[model samples]
Target chain A: MDFELIAESLPRLAEGIDETLLLAGSSLVIGFVLAVPIALLNLSNNGTVRTLSSGYVYIFRSTPLLVQIFLIYYGSGQFRAELQAVGLWFLFRESWFCAILALTLNTAAYTSQIIRGGLQSVPWGQIEAARSIGMPGFMAFRRLIFPIAIRQALPAYGNEIILMVKSTSLASTITILEITAIAKKIISATYQPVEVFLIAGAIYLSLNFIVTRAIMLVEFWLTPHLRVDRRIPPVVRRTPAPVPAP
Target chain B: MELSYLGWGDAGWGDEFARGALMTFAVATCAFLLSLVFGTIFAAFKLSSNLLLRAVADVYTTILRGIPELLVIYLIFFGGGQLLQTIALGLFGYDGYIDLPVFGVGTLCIGLSAGAYSTEVIRGAVLAIPRGQIEAARAIGMNQGQRFWRILVPQSARYALPGLGNVWQFALKDTSLISIVGLVEIMRTAALGSGSTKQPFTFFITAFLIFLVLAWLSQRVFLRAEAWANRGVRSA
Candidate 1:
């Protein structure tokens, strides 16, 4: 209800939004790149490859991302000497790197599943037709399968993107000055938890709204054939009226 | 630094970790139950003919689903008390430091989040029920309550089981976030143990393993429940 407090905090919170977007955007890109190979492993003909991919997915999905973050960030301290020897200690020491690493790993697990589902949904007949046309296996997959699979997976991937955005808030616990962290800082400073959180919530809500809309737009573009023209005139009924005598 | 740090003794944190795991289960159960209650109500509202009620449900699910669970917890934990104080002042004019316990607030926050997802699951399950089955029950002179209990509830349960299982897992994982508000659940126990012992790796790895065990066990239970629910039904 304190308009002045919310107004004063808005500028500070904007920077937090930038950090949030950075964290989410970078992780999503990395996660998607990682997911492709994992998804392929999931759909592999070899049992070991499939099982290994699924095991990775299960481990990530079963544990909370917060725990994973803590394990990588804090747990890595135990191996500081080994990590330093391998030149990886500096990355683990930075909270931002740890957050991104955790997020990417988590999202890769879920995204791989989504991608696998999409890949499986591609009809066998389509691949058969591609093969009949003498297309190479890799070319057929690259040109014919991948496009359809990605289109099929777009909606679920959009949901994953939104989740990743929301998850960036957890980075605050590790001292990342993301949106939620800034809001918490403001609340601590001004003692107006309600106002600051409301403002923060609105920012998140609007950001998600835009993301949802953008996803819908992409979906619309991907499936133009599915959209029906509502303005088209209905077909005229040609049945003759019943006789008055009847 | 030593494995004995995890042993059950005066110096080790074994007892604390065990207690934390129990508390985590308790919170997850309470929150899941609360979520089902909220979900049923909102799902009903969504399926109703009333436009206003449907809009309210839509807004509730959208806002809750979009926001991070961490932010939601912080808002409720910090603002819930203030809101309660304002209500007390306006109604009974009694204003003192009214404290809402951490457990209650943590359950409420996670419950609200879980409810949003559950609402969709329940609504979809209800919609999946065949319309003719309900109509047949009505034709047989069964009342609304009987029809709901005998026909709708059983059928929906079978369809809702898998989605509910996923929600349960989500609630269990989300309890980790409650540690931010100082709830001594598994995550918090690990944090405290790590900070005190200066062996962050050991404590956190222990916490992760505990969670994996819980998740694995619960998954088996849910799978069994799903099988039980599907018994005698022909598979497509």
Candidate 2:
């Protein structure tokens, strides 16, 4: 453990955090946008629609994300003509676009499942009550169902976010110089794997810690009903001593 | 577009991919089995009354789970050999440039990660076992070893199956990371074929399909095992 080396490399590695955060943040946002509809499709009344959506989830979930990244990045080179004709070639040509495309697709699959689980967990009785009140189906879903489901799903989605942050490391293989990629470069140069990786690992762990803490805050905010009034301590119950005569 | 590019022998990359797939399977299997060992040990540590043991297990799992799996592989690949060399030199005054086989490195890294997960699974399974059942075994004058073997192992194993299946899928996927370190697994083979043949789509898609098949098959195997484990137990 060379302390000096760590001190020197810390600044360099810190620079890469922007890329890491950008990659994870953008994909999560885009993936969430994609996930909402896929989740609905997953829970559709029609079997064909449900199966089609689920098949997308299954394939993405089953295969390694690295392969998926490669299939988009390197794999797109083979279809250059078609992609050019469709005007997707420009996006495919850049590693950033390919990486984000792969990541967005991957996270969408996982997020849909998490959303589906959240949707399933929303009580049927609540939905029925909304229906009885003559709330339109869309209104019921928007007002009664979506909020409760999202609150239920937030914790799991937090886990998924952490996983996505970690998944961003795979982007390094495609030449995106994120934190892990920077760590690899430093280690290769310094021949000090243990130290460089330890630093890199610390960065990731701390990033995850911050993300989780933020999610916890979000969870706290979202579930006001669940949040006990911690500001006021519970009143201690007391039994008055038996009075001789009252 | 050239179908024969995947044909067997000198004509194509079929044989290479097959061999690579086999290597991937072997690595995943070995890693998974190794993880079970680490999981049991750490789970015991975690479940122990001793504070030090519990802290050790907690740190192990948290650190392993927090970092990216790719970094874990890099740490082990680059750090492990040096550690081994140091030990050998310290013990016998015999030191050479000792390189760990990529296979062992791949297995060890994946095993360590999967073990962190399995420790939670196994610990949960242990906790799920009814306390009264253990007390009854004690009441019957069963020895500790006898109770563990007869009651604890079987019951906790049954409970741990589903979680362990997820861990196995992760280990299987983690093997692809080994290709980054030149393990020559399916991922590596695909990368090579793609680079050589200039058919990136073909090779990468094949790799993806191969993984899909492996994942599907293992999922079935896990389901069957779960059924077998839960046999004669009431569904309700």
Assign candidate 2 its CAPRI class.
Answer: high
Q: Could you give candidate 1's per-residue lDDT for residues B1-236 as a string of tens digits?
A: 57788989688899999999999999999999999999999999999999999999999999999999998998998898888888999999988878789888899999999999999999999999999999999999999999989999889999999999999999999999999889999999999999998899999999999999999999999999989988969998
Model 2 segments beyond 4 Å from truth? A228-246, B84-96
Residue-level lDDT of model 1, residues A1-246, one tens digit each, is 999887899999988888999999999999999999999999889999999999999999999999999999999998999999999999999999999999999999999999999999899999999999999999999999998998999999999999999999999999999999999998888878999988888889888999999999999998888899889798998999888994
lDDT tens per residue, model 2, B1-236: 77789999998999999999999999999999999999999999999999999999999998888899999999898888778887999998887888789998889999999999999999999999999999999999999999999999999989999999999999999999999999999999999999999999999999999999999999999999999999969997
For residue A188, what is the lDDT in candidate 2?
82
How many angstroms is residue A226 displaced in model 2 relative to the true structure, after the best TM-score fit?
Answer: 3.0
- For each candidate, how many residue pairs have backbone atoms clashing (under 3 Å)? 0, 0
How does each model score on lDDT?
0.94, 0.94
Off by over 4 Å in 1: A231-246, B86-98
True contacts kept of each: 0.83, 0.88
